[model samples]
Target: MRDVNPKEWLALGEDLAPKLKDFDIINPHNFPSYIWAYYVKLRLGERSSAIIWYCHEPLRILYREITDPKGFRFYSKYNNPELKTIDMKAVSQIDHIVCNSRFTANNVEKIFNRAASVCHPGINMVETQDCDRKNFRMVTRIYREKNVERIINAMVLIRETRPDIYENCSFEIVGEGADEGRLKTLVKDIGISNIKFCGFIPDKELPAFYAGAKAIVYIPLDEPFGLVPLEAMFHKTPVIASNQGGIPEKVINGVTGILIDPVVIEVLTDAMQRIYDNPQLANELGTAGRTRVLERFTVDSFINKLEKKFFSLSGVK
Candidate 1:
């Protein structure tokens, strides 16, 4: 893999275009890679290889109104309009587009006026021995769009209103990002003692955290497709996620886990307390979640769908 800087991708794409012709398929995973792929496809006109873009989400800055209208205005305001034009051009030249969820596919279609196939990514099913459930966990990057602060606010409400539940419960934040300092400051300023910032945990060690958690709290604002809840479910841990975005598709409200409008602190606090007060309900949700993952979101299922898409695009079958 070439370690080319993203800022220099356009120039390097000119140099690397000829070499990419050797591959049967050119699959670019992100926007910068899509730009490079566009360069290669342009240089090697009438090429045998097909370019497939695995879009996590369309250029988020272009769809700020839908993704995060209230927040992230700074990024949307300062972003160059040329990037949107270039991304649209690159998307038009691609042979096929696959999105991680239907929500994302719809956004791509709206942006590019092009249809994209939905292919949900899968995860390894993790098995863990039962242990006493402790803290509620959140394993996500502490970004502005993630809505981590919503949960913090909910915790404060829980502390004030439901002291009994709050006394027995603690929240474990298990990831780091650009907003980490601000979030830590928020926690400190509020004087919440139960919330712990455990920094970044290795992938292999994540299961232990999941196993020990009563339930995973994943309430991101307009998440295109979230994997943290799936990972938590795989460890037989219940999930409390937002009702918005592709999360509702993965988590069945009141079945696999509880879903709420995370913007409302009272609703979020109620869900947390419900999960904490009732261990039987938590266990039931956890079991159903694992079953859902096994039946629908396994690695084998994901690979089968992806393999068919690859063969059809490459004319291998």
Candidate 2:
């Protein structure tokens, strides 16, 4: 808004607006925000000082259940309602809505009914995780629904019985959780070092962590939309995600990476073996994923799309 022509400033009313951004929303296939200048226009600010949703997934479902109001790390305090109440309608009423993925867009629309224009999300892709996918690494909040145990069991099975590829590969479980203790027990109960428990790394340094891993893995049995996979893809890393929920929409199976039935360790183990044995296949998939992100998932593109939406609704293009 700082550069908004005086003539345009004369056009908008003073009101708080919503502008969603994400830590890892960028992929050439999905550039959200679309640039950002357009955001200033929507927010009606001296400069765009809108509320940008930090796009929380595992927590979004959990936080809604918190009866007490809480603070948004990026913004400030926000009402704490039942997680189910956070649907699109709740957020849309606030003026604007931005999402990390179209998969998320689909769910947001459920709550708002007529709200939340998705801009995917943006990530600083100047650097990508240097890890190559000769194997697999699982990343997610490890909540109950996230199905962390499944990944561990799958790895154990593969390592014990399927050495063709599993012998050389392992899994990395990133992020901590209530399930952390139990997960450790399961690892010990099964006795597998192939899966490592590297809890949350600081956000800025996460890229380096990812840089060292091969592919990002997520298994949210029924997910709203997971961004970890996309972030992994941002690093030119392939993904092996659950086939449930809206995931198929984000990472195209066989194209971006393999999409398997995370409900069963056998299936997950099978997918891992495939990625391990087929380096050419993994590389091919990861390359396609990178190309997809560059073409559609940039921050600049998101802003543009949103600008068009706002201009159309406000009739102020």
Candidate 3:
């Protein structure tokens, strides 16, 4: 697939609008593609059968500016009023809206004043294997909104307060982003050695990482339908995630995994300790997590639901 720069959205839309009419459905993700779809729908006139928007989140930067200014301040400059107006106008023209989670669907309704259907994205379930699940793992972009520092701080507390638990436990932070250097510096300055930054691991290697982990620590601020937890759960690994956003939909506190406030450092530290102390509890949670994935989050289920939505919108049997 060719990469279309955001700057060329209008030109691309104008060029492709005529050709797009032959297609039954125009499904667009993200703002630029949504703009392109909007133009195509306008140009298609009565020929356009359906324009379904699979929104991950509704202009997150705009919403984050209101909900979390400190975490989203870097993106504040890009939150142009004109751009938001254009995006809203485009969204209003869409025939159907689908979101990845109910959390995101609520955000879409609040932001766009439009009802959206929730179709949770699914993952390929990995076969469970017996492995020495020793280390706590986190697989996420090292960004401010991801709340990586909170986990790092939890590590610091664990080291200082509970030396025995800290001695045995290790953390592996996978994936990289702009906040990586700052987080590494913080780790080094504090002289904590148990945490290792694994950088980006290939998708194929992720199952091994998940399978060998004690728990997947995910505490992103208002994440929109986290796939990391689902991937981890598929490997029969429990997730220790934040209560905020779409994570709660996936990680059930005490049943599938533990959920705590994203801001509180001690809450995260205690949850990790609990998992370490109770192997049976951890195993039970892991088993339940895998069962949850098998029941609700299979790729086949996702595709079937999406197909149903498409058929419903297109007026086809």
Candidate 4:
């Protein structure tokens, strides 16, 4: 709000601040905005107040390693940059907080003296006309954190080791990123021509791909809650993904799709081989995954959780 013309919002805030008295300020990935949020809550909390920060690993890992180590360290005051570094005053301002996963919740407790509830991200599912289903495909965002290179390498190995399955299979790389050029080179270097770089297709267009595919393989380093897999499940497409992050919450291993550490070539290739070897097995897993999503991970459930959390934090009914 400060970066974008605060004067415009000044009147609005002035008018609304007294009339609407609920809404705990949350600065997830607590940037400089947290400072302002803290101040606002301090003034507003004659009744109740909160200011929670959700730290992203990118601020600690990729950004520190790849871009700015010095800047990264300096932002540590709020970034969960290190253990026992969160300011005491900031903690006093907050009531409750949202966490990505139980694993991450433990890390948050170790870093910030805050109890964080796991709130997975949600997506709106769209029902679409069925896809051809014969084309077994894999879809993923090409990025460093996602370990896209491993997917490329595994696909190549799949072709070399099992030529029949390779000839029939199609791997689609969706959502472009830093690894686009490198991934393309890897595909050519490995002599795997069945891959397609379908850059930035809308979510609506995804139904055709999901319906037609055997399963979607989302290989990533660590994800909070990889929504893509659940989205694929909504399409009744099974998922084969890495056993990292909050993936287990969505992907029910053998029931949904094979989960492996995508970083290891042997592990990933072996998992793919299992799927390629058994079409009936893949279909069964896909059906189970879809049912799991309908029950556990849907927009309605996410909204209900958010409302309850908001009420608790704001102390407004």
Q: What is the C-alpha lDDT of each candidate?
A: 0.84, 0.59, 0.85, 0.65
In candidate 3, residue 205 scores what lDDT?
81
TM-score of 3: 0.93
> Which tens-of-lDDT digit does each residue in 1-317 have in candidate 4?
11433343344434544543465445435433443454455445674344555543322432333223324122233334322132445544555657656655655565555677776656687888767665555566666776777777777787878888678877776788777998888788878788888888886788787887766778776565667888888887768887876787778889987888766898877776777778788788878988887887888987787667767765657
lDDT per residue as tens, model 3, 177-275:
999999999999989899999999987788889999999999888788889888888888889998988889888999999999988999999999899
Which ten-residue region of model 3 has the weakest summed lDDT? 65-74
Tens digit per residue, CA lDDT, model 2, 140-240: 77666678877877776777788655556667777887779988988898778777888987778767666555667787765656667777777777788
- Per-residue lDDT, model 1, residue 3, is 41
Give the TM-scores of the predictions, in the order they appear.
0.92, 0.67, 0.93, 0.79
Candidate 4 has its poorest 10 consecutive residues by lDDT at 66-75
* lDDT score of residue 115 within candidate 2: 54
Model 4, position 247, has a per-residue lDDT of 84
Error of 1 at 175 (Å): 1.0
Flag the better candidate by TM-score, 3 or 4: 3
**For model 1, how does the per-residue alpha-carbon lDDT over 1-317 read when each residue is reduced to its tens digit?**
13434457677677878789888888899868888998888788887368888999877766676656667323535455666677778889898899999999988888788989988999887676777788888999888778889878988988889887778878889888898999999999999999999998888888888889999999988888999888888878999998988898899999999999978888888888889889899999999999899888888999999889888866855
Q: Which stretches of candidate 4 lie over 4 Å from their true place?
A: 1-36, 43-48, 52-58, 61-92, 136-138, 312-315
What lDDT, from 0 to 1, does candidate 2 have? Answer: 0.59
Q: List the residue pairs that clash in candidate 1.
A: none
True-vs-predicted CA distance for residue 183, candidate 2, Å: 0.6
